[model samples]
Target: MAEDDRSFVDHYAVLGLPSSEEGTKISLEEIKKAYRNQSRIRHPDKRPNDPNATADFQFLTTSFEVLSNETTRSCFDAKLRTRRERVLRDSFQNAKRRKMATDLEQRERSVAVDPSQEVRRKEKMKADELKREIAEFKARRMKKAFEPLNRKDNVEGEKKDSSLDKGRMLKAIWETSAGDYSAAKLRGIFETFGIVEDVVIRTNSLKKKSSAIIVMASKGATVRAIQSMSGDTTNPLLVLPLESIAPSFSSTSSTNQNESMGPEFNNVVGAGFQNYEAFVMKKLQEAYEKNKCM
Candidate 1:
């Protein structure tokens, strides 16, 4: 089958990203990485002894081979319109086939078919097909995009928590998305944060905070990374400061700041690495000034 003729991944869909609104150009490494993802899923060895699986494998392999080349992905995008369209085309076709089979069963049963119903059914079926295709296209793109996290346990099981290895101590936290780590991007995410010494996520879990820790690579870099990702979903910054973590999570609001400002909870009043370090520092300095004056 032709790659575009119901037999290839849409290039945009494969990348797990939307086509660039700003005319962003595709890069070689991005294409290569996407192909690598398709390879893992569509490789024949991973498939069972099913004819459909084999076809899927071949199709996926072809997609990778073709799209990985700079020229091919550009051509494919024009043909597919949006990445979603390419992803959904095959799935839509498959659903059409199933509906045809069911229609055959209905005919055999001599089900009463109103002419208007048939017309409406035709229109509705078309609309539903489009929706299904779009949804599946999204799913396919996300699947490929996050293929890293959703792989077999061998990959995820490698989540490193405590590495006495190489004298690298760790206090890292593995922070997957809300559900299972359905993608293998955790290690990179942590490294992006501060290069904790180690990182790990459970094989069949989706709890954020995987408990990977690495020492910060550079104070400047780590700080910048943290500042940039304040509202990050995987690692939400403190809505309240770290110094406020104890009180923020513990109490609703600090109505009596004077009464609660005790030395024992100095740690609790410190800003976390995630939010407002400057403000925390300023507050500490202000308190020192007041104490000196007294």
Candidate 2:
């Protein structure tokens, strides 16, 4: 047979002894007989005219020498086993990678088929996010509205028990639309008012809109803060005044006040409002005057 026609080279196959899995248990006598039979046909002297006769004869001789030695045959078997294992491992790995690639391509094709569904999903997500933010904003507003009533109760409780009055610690409540202000920023802002005892920020989260309560060192300092901070300036402010937190304070028309005040202050109450301190101070003055008239 032509060299190109041969599938694979094996010592047993060269000798014409079976190389298949079931024929691996051939006897030494069988191997010698097969080798002798192959050699005679492939001998160069017997086929001197053939161009590949020498090469064929040499291959037959090598097969006999390797198979006849027990050590060489054992080593060749080990090498063959290792090559088979390596081929199987490579095939498994290639198959696994091909399967993964196929799955990814299928997913891409699915997405390409219905891109509109993806867009709709993203839009719904955005809408839900907006609704959540709006709900949080409304909750904060409600808390702000009821702050005065809560403070009123605390003041009344303090009044009923004289011993509880440890020289009325003056405190002021402040709200800011910009939630980026840290405790240090709050302290810096209100430190000008008086010796600050403690600063407490209340909010659902640090990143959300928040309120701060600045406890001043003395009532005199608190009084000074009410007078100085409550005023109109080039820049408007967003803050709650001392009168709003007082026990006697009450809105003349709660519903009307909320409807009117919420809208009226909208333009000036956001993070963009400039001169925030002054604007809030002016609003507090208006609220104080309105309550006094009522």
Candidate 3:
């Protein structure tokens, strides 16, 4: 037979022996026993009426010849192993292709059933991504804004005084549409009224507005800034003292002038100031007068 024809045949199967153990473990005696039994059963003389009996008997003889020799048996076993590996590889590839086709078909069916669901799912994914990006952007911006303060504290080798009174703080609100203002710009603008210790800018993205927490060196500077900036048509900022927002000092009824004024506010509100309330009223009057002149 041709080499191709020989490769296609399972030699041990023809003699009715287990093909798995045939070449590796089957003894020569065992192969001979199987061959004798098969030869007797398939001999052409025994099946004279069967025309294909001759061909079958010839193939049986060839199988016995191949398996009986050690060299031929080893070669046949190698061919069988190669064919089995090729078959397994092809089966795996076909299965993979079938699973991919099935998945694609299911997706198409689902989209056809409810196309709006796909649209909604994609839109939700985009919205979630946008929210995450915005959150990260805001976090980066906050870290950048405070980096200078952090570095300054490190260089000075001192912790900032957290117990400092909030009474020296002023809130300045401005429209975002006006322009972008940095801490340095804000400090320059407010330093004309008093010594600005710190300027912290905050923004409301939704409202399109910005505000600054301006900490002055003393309560006197805080009151001076509030008096000068309030209701000033020239200045865009709307300034309010922290005392007005949330009063820090105790109120007292005083008949004598200058009796209730603290040492910090003595220079800002000179003589005739009866109390803290009177000093605030006087400053407001002065601001009104200044604006009326302007």
In candidate 3, what are the lDDT values of residues 86-152, reduced to their tens digit?
Answer: 7789899999999999999999999899989978999999999999999999999999887766667
Between candidates 1 and 3, which one is better according to lDDT? 3
The numbered model that scores best in lDDT is 3
Give the TM-score of each candidate.
0.23, 0.41, 0.42
Worst 10 residues of 1 by lDDT: 238-247
lDDT string for model 1 (143-187, tens) is: 889776655665555655322242232232333453343224544
* Model 1 whole-model lDDT (C-alpha atoms): 0.52
Indicate the worst ten consecutive residues by lDDT in candidate 3: 267-276
Model 3 local distance difference test score = 0.75
Instruction: Show model 2 residue runs off by greater than 4 Å.
Output: 1-9, 17-24, 45-49, 127-148, 153-294
Q: Put down candidate 2 lDDT per residue, 1-294, tens digits, no spaces.
A: 245235446787788777645335777788889887887788888898999999888888988888788898877677656656876898999999999999999999999998898899999999999999999999999998877667788888778865433232333333455336666876786678678677676665454345566667775565455445544332223444322212223443334333443343323232322244435546777888999899
User: What ranking emerges by lDDT with the best candidate at the front?
Assistant: 3, 2, 1
